[model samples]
Target: MIDFGFTLSKSSTVDLNKIDHSRYDQLVKLVPTARMCMNCGSCGATCTVSEYKGMSVRKVLYGIQRGEDVKAMLSSCMLCGKCTMVCPRGINTRNLILNLCKLYD
Candidate 1:
């Protein structure tokens, strides 16, 4: 039997606590939507793509605002508009992702 774990012991030469919140710090605050979401899992649950890669149309946008690389989400959307219809907020999720696509480019 062999234990294999890559571990770094404490040392003055290594500064493990590197601060890196620049992504979130540089993002513009998302304007609060007038249409309140009921927190229904309908969008996440019924999402056709979720079965493949597990995406929430709502959470992806939130993650983008906080400056996450949400590219993994792009592939999952079928653009079939199921999420838009189910959204109580009437937010155009597909359009949001379409616009978000430009950022990655």
Candidate 2:
């Protein structure tokens, strides 16, 4: 059977110089309010799917910012709007998720 989970070499760290910024830039344009995120954890606290492992808005956003693989986390989002309702910054969390989905497409 294929292992699919082989460990990387110690030197295989992420090359920050090779990271792509196009997708992130497009997302910023589509959802300007995303830049206002305070990493306050309100969105994650209110997420309906937060109880599930590996599904937090804050973590997903951070992954996106770093150009990491966040597709799984984004896919798990229920888009219930609860995060938006409780966001202290009044960010449109639902729309942000929708826009992020479009970006991955």
Worst 10 residues of 2 by lDDT: 7-16
Which residue pairs overlap in candidate 2's backbone?
none
Q: Write the per-residue lDDT of candidate 2 for residues 33-66, one digit (tens) a residue.
A: 8888889998888778878856777777767777
Candidates' C-alpha lDDT = 0.61, 0.82
Model 2 spans > 4 angstroms off: 1-15
Best candidate (score: lDDT): 2
Model 1 lDDT tens row, 37-81:
455666787788888888877667555444556678776777888
TM-score against truth, every candidate:
0.60, 0.80
Task: Report how far residue 43 has shifted in candidate 2, in Å.
Answer: 1.0
TM-score of 2: 0.80
Off by over 4 Å in 1: 1-39
Q: Which candidate is the best by TM-score?
A: 2
Number of backbone collisions per candidate: 0, 0
Q: Alpha-carbon error at 56 in model 2, in Å?
A: 2.0
Q: lDDT (0-100) at residue 46 of candidate 2? A: 74
